[model samples]
Target: MKNNLTKMMALDIYVSNLEEEKYSEITTELQPSSKKSVNLISWGIQDLFFEKELFNDLDTIKTFSKNFNWKDNVSTVIKENYYESLVLTDAEKKIIWVSNGFTKMTGYEKEFALNKTPRFLQGKETKETTKKRIQKKLQLGKPFKDVIINYRKDQSTYKCELHIIPLHNSSNSKITHFLALEKEAV
Candidate 1:
């Protein structure tokens, strides 16, 4: 148990350092500090991994991990380089959340994406078979993985690897939302 805790703490420290380095290089306007000091102790950093501070202050690290809008900090840095994007859509297929990675990948701003169906990301080159497969899976509330050509805001197309899962309500087990994760073709 002690060994495991040590390993976990080491991994947390490593990840915290990497995130800090990434955060420093990302857009300054969007950077979010982890949190105030009070929150860190209150949240019990020792319970997280270690009693020692990670890359940043204990409070900052705690806030960032537990309280802050991690999506914003991660979204900006991740999209500019990494190929990952997350999308959340209602059962009706209207967009609810489109990660910043999606914006960077497709050039469609969040404001433009809200309430919009992902079909807007398709263009002339998009495969009909892939679209139909995606549609069928969603209609059946099935998780799906596929590779398809997708269009960006500039009308340029890129090959995308897509994975989608259905989010279900706990009580009735009815599908409530869809989560899509897409990675750029490498």
Candidate 2:
């Protein structure tokens, strides 16, 4: 219970950080109604009293995202932190989401990356073993972690510590999405 409460608090902080970054980017003042619609300030507070537990596990968060449209918030957090996040289209295995971290790290914007395969980030220096291991884990619908050489939009190479987690519809035991979390290996 205590752990869950801590996670809940952390999520609050996380949301605040994201809101700070998001609002910073907007120069115009929105009308009162528009602000209420665009931001979740009051909604977040109101929903804090819900009956559900508040643990921040990846799966639990994914479930909330699926049910309540928190998916945008999830990716926005990654974008705000300049941390790479990619969501594959479950079975089809195409890019469905790419965070701004792609832009900060690779110079590729969300508009250009969506609908493209993640392989676009790979180049000659990307090792065969790394690719194969990722593929194997993905095929097994299991979480995978590895360091891989990835290329930017400029085609420059950098080592990335990649963590790919299979997001499942736990009730049905079916993979609904994959989350690719990455950090600079430097």
Candidate 3:
């Protein structure tokens, strides 16, 4: 029927917009008929999407841990927190890898953040004292947690909590990288 065809078309459009991350445009353009279908699709798809993302994150963590010979430590950390984003930086504080969730949270794609320092996320509103504290913690070479204001690519500010752990090379027992489990403060 024409009604069925229209609903299917609307669902397709809605899905396309979701894939494009056009969240702001989705609500304004929604129709009553399409809304119901979208709701149903969202319920079904959201779980699968979450599972896939979780698996991907786990795999990334596994790979990094294996490379760094810190599987046991990383596994314990993973069990303790559900992170929204993961960032890996060299000992020098240059970003090396970021999870897809990092882009979702910060609006900065991995490519844009690669080879840059996490300091790029800081802005005028970010506290200098917080920066100093983070520096001190990093120098201590210990795992620590802190919250700070971070700016998105669009320049919007958000409270970000970082659980930072130092990655030490097993052979040399020297710090090689820092892994940050990041989440947006609710």
Candidate 4:
């Protein structure tokens, strides 16, 4: 279902972040109403939400096209592959969902993570300016990605290649979800 929507939205990278307020701001600014039809925004948000969730589970992400209810909406040629990473969200953001990959990277299982903020991953080394930029963009409901430092359970720091995207219901053009992606480097 989500894969179909991604093709429709032509999304290169799909992500949801824990920081809903910040991601919301970016969406409103970058995706202008004059540029995109309401229908397009609705479809994109719905599809991206499903895709991010499916991507979290190894099985779901692998069998997405086959198991999803929206088989009719997706293309047959789409590929299924999961990227191992950590997914984090704020207590407020958990109402939406989190991905399985999140546990793999952060060593924190979903059961222990739900209702917690991903800011736990941020430490003294995390860049303040980059953090502010991400927060500001998400506050506006926009998509964002950048490299910044984040802490892990071991208190070890690594570069986080982060991606955050906003999901809108579009009935009122409201951003209901913020998707986040975090991969380690450096």
lDDT of 1 by residue, 82-113 (tens): 23566778789898776666787888898999
lDDT of each: 0.62, 0.60, 0.80, 0.54
lDDT of 2 by residue, 123-145 (tens): 99999997997788789876555
Q: What TM-score should be assigned to candidate 3? A: 0.70
Q: Order candidates by lDDT, high to low.
A: 3, 1, 2, 4
Over 1-186, each residue of candidate 3 has an lDDT whose tens digit, in order, gives: 567755654564345325345765575665565445332557667667656777887788788878777623775676567678889998999998998999999999899999999999999999999999889989988777777899999999998878888888777778889989897765
Which regions of candidate 4 deviate over 4 angstroms?
Answer: 1-82, 86-96
lDDT of 2 at 186: 45
Q: How accurate is candidate 3 locally (lDDT)?
A: 0.80
Candidate 4 structure quality by residue, lDDT tens digits, 87-151: 43432566223566666667666676667666767889987997887777778766666667877
* Winning candidate number (lDDT): 3
Please identify which of the two predictions, 1 or 2, would achieve the higher lDDT against the true structure: 1
After superposition, which runs of candidate 2 have C-alpha atoms over 4 Å from their true positions?
A: 1-64, 67-89
Predicted structure with the largest TM-score when compared to the true one? 3
Alpha carbon deviation, residue 8, candidate 4 (Å): 27
Candidate 1 residue pairs that clash: 34-64
